[model samples]
Target: MRSSVILLLVGISLAFAGKHSLKYFYTSVSGDKTFTATGLVDDVQFMYFGINTKKASPKTEWVREIEESDYWKRQTHLLVEQHHWILNTIWTESAGEHTYQITYGCEWNDETGKTNAFRQYGYDGEDFLFLDLKRDEWISPVKQGFRTQERCNNETIRLVHWKNYLKMDCIETLKKLLTLGKSSLEKTVSPQVSLLQKNACSPVLCHVTHFYPSDITVTWMRNGQELKNVKVGKLLPNEDGTFQKTVTLQTEADEWRKNEFSCVVKHQSKTFRKTLTEKEIRTKNKTAAPFDVTVVVVLVAVILSLSLIIGVIGYFVYQRKLKPALSGSASKCWLSFCRISGYVTANTSPSDSENTSQSSTES
Candidate 1:
């Protein structure tokens, strides 16, 4: 009777064990680039994953980052042979436009409910076959870590994981985020060159204006070298929603000959760009030169003329004193010296003949 009881107990245990059904669900995606799903099962564990890209060769099988609890949990239950777990599944989109495909597949041990965690699976020339399910089916958006019915939508399904049950709606959210990033990529500041001055001035000043949404940085580069001693000015925003910065560079009179300056605009992840120098800064300088020259010439002439007049008056007073010191013969000598020296050159011209003096004697 004890033997019969043992047989009956074993049969019952086997039947109950066979009845236990373990269902593992996940999603796979494909398109531009291919990646597999992470966090395959909460109580269950990640087994393995396969990565394949069109442009590149397929990657060797690798395991995802699994938690200690997941590892320990799988250990508690004895593992069986050839158990495949859902691995990395992600969607890749094409360039220029938005399109993606998801690829994922898994094989679980039917005999043992627990998975074989130690072994790695390699791609044997056959691509993974995944059941593409509706993305909305698996998307249960959780607020505060709890899934809700309101967040679920039916149309959110992705075609990549139609075979298996992995929530694919998250791909839509990822795609949306990527699209947003791409749209703003063009909006980033691109270096532009423009001429601010049509005519050159003494110190040619170049104004660089950047049309960007955020605060901008401006640097002056002269022939690919960073400029120093440049009179840098403030950056101000225009009424029409753009930024304007002014930099004044005093080119040595020689610099105007080459006549070039560059304003480089720098922003995040942006590169070399320049604004052409203005013709006005150089042209304006030309107009200023004639005016400056004329002023200097007039100032010098006035100074020289004033000095000549003063010298003539001083000489006349000195001679009057000399006449008293030498009254008689010396007076005649002094007069002869003055005439020979041409002291009266202003009153007489070389082309005119001189008139002789009449002698009057006091007897």
Candidate 2:
């Protein structure tokens, strides 16, 4: 039961593992030369070569010819025959989008006779698979894949020698290509900086746009001192393959007018600064006056309306209490008046009869 539960959990975990397209790139760097070969796994389960910029033939022509070559066919057959089970299992079990990259490269040191070579596998940008140079064993993060590869000891041994041979043979071609690419590349471009204000009281934004290499620094300063309340946005890629960034400095209208706030951008060994002046703030405030007036008016109207509603409710509640008290008091007063009148009439009538009898006796 325990074993079954463990296996079930492992299966469920692996079910959500991401599927990835496989891409292999080979680079040889020797002296000033560089050579590269890139292959992508296609939908038909075969490796398709993309570009060999070193070749004289057109890229499409080379891809077409390579597909029909005996080497390509044999390699494809060997890969499918040896690893079809693992590939099929991964394809069936995994889910979502990801790409697996395999980079094989050899760098030949001019002073040293031997080459430094590596074969590494990564998912997205993180490396998780490697080949042991001495043991020729496959190191993988996937438990199942590692276990399966471990069983193929003889094949692993053969692959080690083959990879070593490839590293040695490709180093010369790579060095030449590196030199060619370096010679043709252009110098990096500097970033352009601009100041943007959304409104008078809002944060002042310093936009740095169209920079090459993507490494840049943007900072905000207030009164010649670096400000800490600076918000830097993410580095965004532009449509033209350059990068852009924005840094914002928050300040009140009075503070902005009182102190000199500046946006400083450093890119490609050049520094650019744009300052926020009192004039700009005044202009923005002037433009926003109508909007500010409208907002104030709306707020005052809402407050007045609420006050009127509250006054009406208070008056009604006062009237309700006053009416009940007045009714009770009126009933009490009427009762008191009737009692007093009855007492007075009884006393006065008795007194008058006594006075009349006394007057008749005197007569």
Candidate 3:
């Protein structure tokens, strides 16, 4: 029984290990003459290197800097040179402010002990070249420079070997780090949905915040049809050891105002949906002015009619019974009618009035 309990605990811990990642990012901005780079393990920065051309040579940091010879120095120099070469090759008159980023990462599955390696080079946040080292494949834009099919294939082989080497050398350390960094499983958070308008175009945004275990999907649908022009931002870390992400769908104002849009979020095998209706959108934008005005007029007419009916009933009751019994004057009967009318009007809430108006209109 003790052995079984230990095995179960181990299985649970492995289940919560999530995806382990190691990423290298390089970014250069020509307009600002700044270059920045970092090496991250599971989204935690372990090394940072940067250079501002307006300043001195370069700044460097390695958490394990002392455990090296001049290896990092040489690597940093080569990286800076490579950045300059790529920048020169891709620079254009129209490309005033340009950025280049290279990301290499591996995701490890604790349960399967399987790993997938990825390498991507992007310009201005768009992928120009991508390599799936595990599959030994490459994807590049047609107009990208210095990236040929043969070269990419060759680089893929080298990177695959390098990834294996790193795994063999660092997997144990990385696993320990991941274990230390693992967060407790928190309750799944439902996404918040809203419509945003920019440049006369509206986009529905589903923001999922403060969730655990990183694996979540956000999908947008229009009138029960899935949308293609959807933008999903990267899953980002929160300060409190949770995760957040945003998914946006770009839609035309007419479509947004006429169709039903829904944001569906799936996390931890559970699904949540937030739906926006055309009427709700119209009401939010205050474009249902005519409908609102019509409703108000109908409500007022119903209320006045109700008050008048009640007043007549009261007047008749007073004249027939109360007036004869008390020998009341005409002014007293009028007062009773006025009091009933005032009470009916004063007791009618806006919601009740609206409901009554709608019921009458429907009838």
Best by lDDT: 3
The lDDT values for all models are 0.38, 0.54, 0.61
> Against the hidden reference, what TM-scores do the models get?
0.25, 0.38, 0.49
Positional deviation of 255 in candidate 2, in angstroms?
3.5
Q: Give the poorly placed runs of model 1, Cα more than 4 Å off.
A: 1-201, 258-260, 267-363
For every candidate in turn, the CA RMSD to the true structure comes to 29.4, 23.1, 15.8
Measured with C-alpha atoms, the lDDT of residue 66 in candidate 1 is 20
Q: Could you give candidate 1's per-residue lDDT for residues 85-196 as a string of tens digits? A: 2122212211242222223323222246432111111222222222224232333223321222233223344323342222322322222222222223124344343434
Stretches of candidate 3 off by over 4 Å are: 1-12, 15-17, 30-33, 41-47, 52-98, 123-126, 132-139, 143-174, 183-204, 220-243, 248-262, 269-271, 275-363
lDDT of 3: 0.61
lDDT of 2: 0.54
Query: Residue 217 of candidate 3: its Cα lDDT?
Result: 78
Quote model 3's TM-score.
0.49
Candidate 3 residues 1-363, lDDT tens each?
234323333433644545666667777777776677776665555566767532212122323323335646766777778667756665543258877777766667676778766667787878778765555566686565345645757765666675664555345445443443344232334444343333343465567787655677788888888877889899888876567888877766556558878887777636777776543333344423122446779999999999999999999986787555565476676667754443324477988767666665666
Over 234-253, each residue of candidate 2 has an lDDT whose tens digit, in order, gives 98878765678988877776
